[model samples]
Target: MTNSPVASPAQTAHSTGSICEFQPVIDELRRALNSTLKGKSEAVELVIACLLARGHLLLEDLPGLGKTTLAKALAMSVGGRFARVQCTPDLLPTDVTGFSIFNQKTREFEFIEGPVFSEVLLADEINRATPRTQSSLFEAMAERQVTIDKMTHRLTPSFFVIATQNPVDSHGAYPLPEAQLDRFAMKLTFGYPDRASELEMLAENIGAADRDRSPLPAILTPNSLQHLQDHVAGVHIQESVLRYLVDLGTATRHHRDVTLGLSPRGLLTWQRVAQARAHLRGRDFVTPDDIQDVAAPVLQVRLSGDFESPQTIIETVLNDVEVPVCS
Candidate 1:
C-alpha cells in the first residue's frame, strides 16, 4: 500500500491484451493438463495462477494423488527442464543445492549443479528431508541464487518449485519449520477426484495419444512465460483494494486463534496472486473478488492457528473485514 500510488480500476484499460495475445498457448496448456489429470480443473487453475505469479507451491496430499503428474505436465507445457528429487530423511543439503568436487584435470573445485538448477523442480515428499537439507533451498527460493564455497550461482529465471508432503506418515518426517512454510506462496491439496473423474482416470492412457491425434506441445518458452508473468505483475489494483487487503491482513494478526499472522512479505504475495487471479480472469485490473477468491490458498501457507482449521480461521478473518466496493 505504501510503494506506489494506487490507480483507478478504470485506468486499467492500457494494461489489457498483453496476456490475451498468449491465449492460444494458455488454452493448450490447460488442455494438455486436463488430459493428464482428470476432473481437477480448479487445482489446475490455481497452479497456473501460482505459476504466473512466480511463486512456489506446497502440495500436501496422499501418495498417488497425481501431484507429480501435475508438476511434470506443467514443466513440459512450459518447455522447461524437469527435475525430481524424492526427498528422504538421509537427503543431504549438498544433494539439493549441489557441492564442490575436486577435478584433477581442471585443477579446481568445480560446482556440480543439483536439482535446484532446473526450471521446474519437484521436491517430492519434501518433509521427509532433514531440516538442514531443507534450509539449503531457502536461499535459492528467496534470492534465486545459491552460494557455494564463496561462489554464487543463479537459478533459472523461470524456476518454479512444486514441493509435496505426505500427511499420513509422521514417523520419519520433520514438520516444516514456520520459516520454510512462509516461503511458499500457497499450500494446496489434491484431494481424490469425484467418482466420475475416477472412472475417467481409469480410462486414460498416454499410449492412446495417437488415437486422439493430440499430444502435449511446448505451449510457451521460459522467456515467453516470463513476459506473461510481467504482464500479470502489471495488472492494476485500486487504492481501496489495498486498504481492504491491509485490513484483512491485520485482522488475521489480531485474531485470537492465530499465533502467527500474515507477514509483510506474505501480504505482498497476496497482492501479486490477486493480480494473477485478475489476469487469469482476462482482466487488467484487480477487484475485491480477486483478493477474496485467492485468500484461502494464500493464507493456508502463511497463517498458523492453535485450535481451528486454517479454513475456519481464514473464514473468520475474511468475515471480520469489509471488502471494498470498486467502481
Candidate 2:
C-alpha cells in the first residue's frame, strides 16, 4: 500500500471513545483494498467510505479498467454475498427483483429471490437495461427492499450496490436518469494504471495458473460490518460544521451554471459520507477537511448544470463556499 499512513486505529479510538472503536477494522479494510486495487489507492479509500456510509456506488469508465475487480474485492473483503446482474436491453424488472413460481406438487407459489437479494450486488452495464427495468432498482436502492405482488421482501442487512455504466456516448448505452443518478453515493472512474502498476499486473498475469482466482481475503462478517456502520452513524458533527455543509449545498443551488442543485437527500448523504470519511481516519467528529476531502466526488455524482464538466462545476462550488474552522 503506497498511500500515506492514516491515523493509528489505537490512538484515535481512545479519543473518540466507544462510538469509533472499530477504527482498526476499517484501517485493515483500507489496506486490503489498497493492495487489491494496486495503484488506485485513493479510489479504494473512497469506495470503503461509501460502503461504511451504507451508500451505493456508481463506476463510470471504459471497459477493461478493473471496475468489476474492485467491486469483487470489496465484497470478498467483507465475506459478503456477491451477486451480479448483467443489464441488457431486454432485461425485465422481474429479472432483477426476482419472481414468484408456482409449485405444481405443493400447489403453492414460491418466491425465488433475485440477484438483488445479496449483500453486494454488481449491476454491470446498468444503462443497457430498459428504463422500466432500471426503475426497478430505485426502490431497492432507496429503501433496501423490493416490492413484488403487493408484498415486500427485505434485502440482506449489508445490502450494498456497485453499479457500472459505460460512457453515454458509446453506442447501445442509455444515459441514466437524474433520479437514478441521485441514488449513487459517489461516482468514481478508474483510468489506465500507471507504468509501474501495469508492470506488476503483467507479472501477476504471467505467474497465474490457467484459472484466475480472487486474491481478496474476508476480514469481517455481515454482523461486524453492520456494527461498523452503527459506529459511523455515531461520528459527531458539530453545529458549525453542519452549517458549513448546508452553505455548500445552498451555494450549489444558486450557482448560475447549475440547473439542479444538491437535493435535500443529497445533502444528508453528503453528511453521512463525510462522517464515514472521518471515522475511517479514526476521528469521532466531522471536520471541514473531511467535507472538502469528499466534496468533489459526492457532488460530482448528483450535481447537474450547464458547465463544461461536473468536476469543474464542483471545484467552483468548493471555492465559492467558505470553509468553517472548528476548534
TM-score of each candidate? 0.91, 0.92
Clashes of each: 0, 0
Worst 10 residues of 1 by lDDT: 6-15
Candidate 1 TM-score, C-alpha based: 0.91
Error of 2 at 28 (Å): 2.3
Tally clashing residue pairs in candidate 1: 0
Per-residue C-alpha lDDT of model 1 across residues 1-327, encoded as one tens digit per residue: 123332422122233355555455556667888877788888888888899899999999999989888888888888788999999989988898999999999898888999999888999988889988888887888888888988999998889999999888888888898878988999899798899989876676545664674545677777777877888898999999999999999999999988999999999999999998888777889998899999999999888879657999888888879877898
Q: List pairs with backbone clashes in candidate 1.
A: none
List per-prediction Cα lDDT, in the order shown.
0.84, 0.84
Query: Which residue runs of candidate 1 sit more than 4 Å off their true CA positions?
Result: 1-17, 206-215
